[model samples]
Target: MANITAADVNKLRQVTGAGMMDCKKALVEAEGDFDKAIEILRKKGQKVAANRADRDSAEGAVIAAVNADKTSGVIISLNCETDFVAKNESFVKLATDLATLALNYETKDDFLAASFNGLTVADKLTEQTGVIGEKIEIGSYEKLDGPFVGAYIHAGNRIATLVSLSANVDGAEEAAKNVAMQAAAMAPLALNEEGVDSAVVEKEIEIAKDQLRQEGKPEAMLDNIAKGKLGRFFKDNTLVNQDYIKDSKLSVSEYVKSVDSNLTVTGFRRVALA
Candidate 1:
């Protein structure tokens, strides 16, 4: 067996981001051959990952990345089994790195399968799960593209939101951030009433009518009362119709118009661990 030196272990650790002990052990197992040592570590990770496959990974970090043009962005969540591990330095870095990699990916499936360093993302997550000794996974991913796109990761990195706007004009970027923040805070059901699912609208109306009936409201007034409740649903649950957080006097639509009359939210996605 080739004696593995500290330099050899550190070099391997730098190359693979594997733990010092793991790197040293792999180097000894591989007779100090660098590439072979990496393979050894990967196999170890694969084994651990497979063994923990059934474990629940519900805690982790949410991270967002945007391009220089501010016209594209991605929000991703890297989940682990424990809050302790989720807040680890290495775990957060892995989340950020995957988010950066998400820029070139069109779908979360492809991003997970995409290569990073010498390993696919899924492989890397498996590898890290071994290193971290936890069940880990990529929980959610969202890609945003439009004239203006912005993302916000709430304080704990447990919630993230991405907002896309129709025009990339003056104040668009700032407006986009405010809207993304609104999304993170208020969690509107849809961008607008037009974007609301018809079935969802029907469900809201039915629930409203049921509540009114339970309150002993007259049957003849049910239709009119439900209609009014439905209108309130649009105002409360739709992004554009909801009052802006900064200035409640204006709807989100009016607040955005204050930025640029032609600018408006085109799409949005919100991901939260809770």
Candidate 2:
């Protein structure tokens, strides 16, 4: 048997982020061959991932990254099975690194295929599933690009948002981040009434009409009342129409306009841990 020294086990541990004993066992299984030991560890990860395929990875980190020019941004949620693993420093760092790398790819599939320290992002997540003993995966991925874009990550890494503006002007950073925070806190469904889906609008209108009928309103009046209620729904649920959380007197649209008359929130994306 080839001698599996302590240094060899430690090196494998560093390279694979596996438990010390697991690294030692893998090295012994590979007869102290580093490359073969790494392959064994990867196969172990693949096996663990397969075993945990049905598990729910509902808790983890929500992270966002924007390019230096602030014209584009991406937000991603790296999900795991438990809050205990989500709170680990190394786990948060991994999420942060993934978010940073995600800025280079426009789609989740592309990001998963991108290289990370010689491993694809998807492979890394599978590998981490074995190291952490939990199902690990990316739960959400959103990208935005415009004249200006900014990101905000809520405390504890539970929520993240990206906001895009109509123009990149002075104070755009502050404006964009403030709007992004509003998005994180309010969880707006869309940027404006025009952005709302037709199905959602129909559903809200029907719900409003049903509520009016429950209140004993006449059937003929239901259409007008429901239309008004739908307008209120848009104001409450749409990003630009919602009242600003910081200064409720002004709408989000008004607040952005205060920064610059030409400035407007063009788009936004939000993701939260489930």
Candidate 3:
């Protein structure tokens, strides 16, 4: 058997971010062969990932990143099994780095296939699963781009949002960010009434009719009353029509118009830890 030194164990730990004991065990198992030790550690990660495949990864950080031009942005969540692992500085940094990398890709599958530190992002998540002993994975990936884009990450890293504006007008940054904040806080279902799902609209109308019938309203009035209720639903659930969180006296559309009458929210994406 080859002798394993503390230096060998520390080197493996540095390379793999594995715990000292894990690195030492891996080194010993590989009989002091550094390359073999790394392979062993990776196999351990794969095994751990398989074992935890069914575990819930509900806790971690939500992060957002925009390109230098601010015309595109991505929001992602790096999820783990517990809040303890979620709160680690390194874990949060990993999430932030992933979000930055994600800006180059349009979809989660492409981002996972992209390389990071000589490993694919998916492989990195598997490796982290072994190192952290949790089901580490990317829970969400959302991307948006337009004439101007802005992003917001709420405190505790639990929520993140991205907003796109119709034009990169003056004060566009502040307006976009405020809209992004509104998205993170209000959780709008769609950008506008037209963007809402048709099935959802029908369901709301049916629900409104039911509620009005329960209130003893006449059957002939159901259609008109339901139409009014549907309008209220749009005002409450759609992004542009919803009341601005910063200034409830102004609707989100009115507030953005206040910024620039020609500027409007083009798109938005929101993701939260789940």
lDDT score at residue 1, model 1, on the 0-100 scale? 78
Question: What is the per-residue lDDT of model 1 for residues 1-274, given as tens digits with 9 covering 90 to 100?
Answer: 7988898989988877789999988998899898898889888888888899999988999998988888889989899999998888877988999899999899988998999987899888887877777888888888889888888889978999889989888888789889989988998999888999999998998999999999999999999999999999999998889989999999988998888877778899898997
Which pairs clash (backbone N, Cα, C closer than 3 Å) in model 3?
Answer: none
lDDT by residue for model 3 (1-274), tens: 8888888888888889999999999988888889888888888999999999999998999999999999999989999999999999999999999999999998889999999988999999998889989999998888898999999999999999999999988999999999999999999999999999999999999999999999999999999999999999999999999999999999998999999988788899999885
Mark the 10 consecutive residues where model 2 has the least summed lDDT: 37-46
Model 2 lDDT per residue over 170-229, tens place: 999999999999999999999999999999999999999999999999999999999999
Runs in model 1 lying further than 4 Å from the true structure: none
The lDDT per prediction is 0.88, 0.94, 0.93
What would you estimate as the lDDT of candidate 2?
0.94
The TM-score of candidate 2 is 0.97
Pairs with backbone N, CA or C atoms under 3 Å apart (clashes), candidate 2: none
- What root-mean-square deviation over C-alphas does model 3 reach? 1.2
Question: Of the candidates numbered 1 and 2, which has the greater TM-score value?
Answer: 2
**Counting only residues 3 or more apart in sequence or on different chains, how many pairs clash (N, Cα, C under 3 Å) in candidate 3?**
0
C-alpha RMSD between model 1 and the true structure: 1.5
Return whichever of 2 and 3 wins on lDDT.
2
Regions more than 4 Å wrong, model 3: none
